[model samples]
Target: MHKEGKVVPLAAATDRGARTPLPCLPVLLLQVRDKAALQLRQGLQALFDNADDTLFEMADKAADRFDQHLYFEAMRDLRLKRKSIERGFLDIFYDTFARIGQVDPLGFMAANEPSRNKAQMERAASVEGMVARVLSRDGLALDQLSLRLQTLLECTLAPQHNPLGPAALSGYFLQAGRNLGVGLRVKLILLKLFERYVLRDIDVLYGEANQLLAAAGVLAELPPAPRRRAEDRRNDSRRISATLEPDDIGADSVGQAFFASIQGLLAPARGRIAPRLHAVATAQPIGTADLLRLLSHLQHYVPAAQEEDDFDLGQQLEQLLLRVSVRSGTRRRIATADEDMINLVGLLFDHIHADDNLPHSLRTLIVRLHIPLLKVALLDKGLFSRASHPARRLLNEIGAAAIGWETGSEGLRDSLHLRVERIIQRLLNDFTEDASLFAELLEDFLAFSQDERRRNELLEQRTRDAEEGRVRALQARQQVQQALNQRLRGRVLPQVVVQMLVQSWSQVLLLAWLKQGEGSPAWRNALATMDTLLASILPQRDPQALLQHVPGLLKALREGLASVALDSTATRDFFQQLELLHLRACAGAEGPAEVAEVLVAEDIVLAIAEESACAPLRQPDEHAAQLRAVQRLRIGAWVEVLDDDEPLRCKLVARVDSSDRLVFANRTGLKVREWTAQGLAQALRLGEVRLLDDGLLFERALESVLDGLRQQQVH
Candidate 1:
């Protein structure tokens, strides 16, 4: 239109329509760990996880969707935090904030926008004052007011405030800001002043926010909160009334709902189906004493199992114990993590440990209570080899204590100085007189032992499952290796191998060689071939669409074939066949480097898939059996596996720890055999396992695991 001399005034037109930008937090500056970017990305993903608006494609592009201004605000805040390395300044700042567990800026901004409006007006008014003097009368025009107003906003401050910082005004504006240039300028000035004087500085409004967050965080930290969702508040109130002194019930206005819930719970129940519930409406932070009382109250409603089973409380009791087990205790400070965790664990353990208080028969039931919490604790601390310490000790104690209690009767003996031979005799004498009470005591002990046994079994089973999973992964890789082997034996063509083109050719070669390309053909040729193969195969697998995962599958196959266990020719031949197949399938053009961006290989399966290798790291599912239990464990618990070592030589993951059998996922059955306070030292130690990004280490360890499996199969 401009070329045709239509004179469509772009700036004028846009300026006419441009509404004033609302006061908003700058886009959030996320913590970047290269390792932890995934976490930031995940949190962002959750913000748009629903069907409303989730249009981000590239992880970087997601920045646009975030309020960049808010992010800039955050970045500016971080800069003010301290002079840091720009190379990774954002990452470092965010990492520190994340570790400190600060609220995400965007979330806070969204939730508190109305709260920010007043502050924005004040800052804008300050700017309006300064800009008033500078504006020519011509700048006062209604048509150009918006354009001229932007000029002051963009002005760099005179060595006092950065351009990104709002400019302060000496005076304020009350009205007509859009129509009058002087008023607009004054308003802008005030906006800047507010930012500089009171608003942007976190100290001003953080106290109340902190208080609110602390209450929510503590409640979230407790495992029992979620399950109590369905309970009647009236019933809960009654229960608490029965147990809590009247003064204790209403000590906190913050705990009013809690009291109400207590009152409802203790209200006389009609029958077995209508026992009391526990309080939950209160968001007040719970003290240790309060938690214990709540736990006791919850236990009261669990309904006896059966009339004669001696374990009176049925599934309700079992579930209550499970709920209690989920949140081990709140994560307080790391220095006292051990002490706090030990005390909490000790409280529960000691409760069961005392046979006289409850009875020896209930030990198994206590063990059952311990299971879900123990699992959840592992999840929280699993990523850091260092964090696993408390969990490991906890597990070990359970095992050791169980063995000790079962054989020697320490818990029971403390309560009643009786021999194992006389335990049954004394038990009948104490409970048979009151058949119902006797059943209650007997069931308690039975539940204790049975639950402990179940817990031990669950741990042992999880360990075995993890071990077998590692073995299966190795076997799956070996199947590919065998295919390469047949090709190497002259039964298959050398042109079949495809990895000569991948960047990780060296690693791939460790598993098997590409037969098609001469040697290390540019990854470009392999990519072209890959594209061609994908396009062609797309038609064949159209109905099935297995090719969607082919890229990663291929990468895994290459990794399997590329091995350097000892410069064996068999490995070379295995890869040759892979090369031939790769060439036949690919498009014959190079693949985009963009593939490297998203598909940063994190494990063996990913290593080969140049474009589809990496998978997003998952947080523990709250509903999943893990996170709902224990949390904030120290990193000093589990054993570690490190570097490119062979099996048995592979670093230990977790030994028979006195702490607990901290669970690990061994994709490659490398046991805990390394040392250092941080973790595996190479890959980020996740739980008991290492998540590897280093290609060489990945291939080497996977190969070692595979070789071990091959030998085992042969034997």
Candidate 2:
């Protein structure tokens, strides 16, 4: 049997709780003891006698202590990063060289002659040279690249020197000498450079490397290089090609082939990029110095992260995105990445996409917090959440994807740059009317919040203001259109037709007023007369036989609005004749009388009778009547695509006629059979459209437009 312990009543549980008499030490004895304890902190008995003063002195000391402690914590971070980069860079160097089989790359560098090595040495020497070639073909300037490369190499090779100056290239190698291969024995290097030079950024380093390759005579045009647009062709309106000194064909060509094979070695972090400092002697003849050069880049970049004021970076990124969007007619260079920035950006992937809701000015400041973060700005689909914000989660994304949890590699980097360029262009073109929505939201937040309150009085006032603002904006657009229509409608009939054709196109809104034949009487007469004419008719009568006069009326109004020569009397007679002819097209398939009622409502009665309108497409068999059938023609002949309602519904495509009749195709892979361009021309019923063949060679067209602009000289 388990027995429970007895519990006393709360009042009597403890002698003290029951208010038992206390047994205490003598006051004098206690005082003496307190004094001793206070002295140790500076003595208790006197301390008990003067406790307040002592406590005040100690508080000041504690505050001083914390300030110093904070400094040390910051110092600790700097040391950790310095060490991580130092170690990683050296290891990368050694591994990169060792695998390449450089027997004594370090020693080879010391010896000026062609050192004895495998066939790969000749190839390894040419690596930088070839990479330059490939990049130039993609578009890069090489003259400035050489200096950057030389700087990086010097810093790595001699870490004891002032790396920020000319000695940086050598210092880089010396810092990672062990990894450079057997024979590098440099001491006092890391300490010297750390105290000495500032390193180059990753973009400058890679950019330099690419330049070296291009200078070595390697850039080659690839088959898929976008068809060289003549307007964009490597020609200048008033400039000449710079003199180019070609490299030895035999040496450079062989080098390019070898370098291409080894390009795989540079793929880092995703696939394997062995520590460049570890360039070991092998059949491939890679050098230890070469290894040092490679890892120097890593040392220059890795472990460059630090905590930052995040708010500033977001705004800066947004501003830059806007800048990129508005720039036109020029190619912009995209940076590969800076070493530290890429990691920082990788760390903050989710943050970049997170809704920071910062003020516009502050957004730019936050973006400067991390450069890499900006790389992802506007790239993400505005999707991110609380769970994804953790640092560890972002790091995981980096490890999984070459470019921040998505596909991007060296190959992809170039493509991403191209895509970025297109997105910028598209945005500028599409967003002409609306300024950034995000920008507007931040600016209007206070008023928006006030307007949204549920209180009826405030709500009604805000709603009235908003409605007024919208009405004013719409009125402004209508005013602009009226002015534009008046100017265009008075001249250029073909252009006028394009502008005023009532259809699905953007410019159709201008057609309403123009449909009246530029006269008030014509619209009123047609409206009244047509209403009575359509009052009675059979539902199933054929539509074709009744519309003989309708097309001519539309023709006259079009000509009149354009201020072109036209027979006004004939135009009136045609519409007067069509008063009884049109059947409403919008009326249901049930037939003619309902069609006539809808026709009066459509307000097209006058246009149909006045205009000899061309429709968009025709029957396939009509090809014979439209054109004399040809036996054969070369590929690439321009032909119009066929449709039945509007010529606009028809367009141009490449065509060739063979023994079989006609063949048509477009560059985008559109192919057509059993229809011909001639058939399309005849089929157009209401929209008169025409094709201008090859439509002016690109350069000529541009020059014709731009050459007339007087160059404004700024002093």
For every candidate, C-alpha RMSD to the true structure in Å = 26.7, 38.1
lDDT by residue (1-715, candidate 2, tens digit) is 1111223333222222123332232222222222221212211111122222222222223357654444344334334443344444334332322222223223333354556465334423432232333344322322233332233222232211212121222333344433322110111222222211212112233343444334443231212222233333223211111111122111123223432342332224221112221132221322333322332322222221223433333233334333433453322221222222232233343333331221122222222323222222212211121112111122222221111111223432543233333333333233222223222322233223223222322333343333333334344335334444433333322222222332211122223224333245643443332222232222325555435433554554444333432355643544443333334332335324411111112222111222112232334444443344222323333433224231111112223222122333322223332234554434322223223233212222223322322121111
Per-residue accuracy of model 1 over 398-471 as CA lDDT, tens digit each? 33333222212353453221322233333323321122332233334433544454454445455545544444
- For model 1, state the Cα shift of residue 133 in Å: 35
Scored by TM-score, the top model is: 1
Error of 1 at 276 (Å): 24
- Residue 682 displacement in candidate 1 (angstroms): 36
TM-score of candidate 2 against the unseen true structure: 0.15
Deviation in angstroms for 471 in model 2?
61
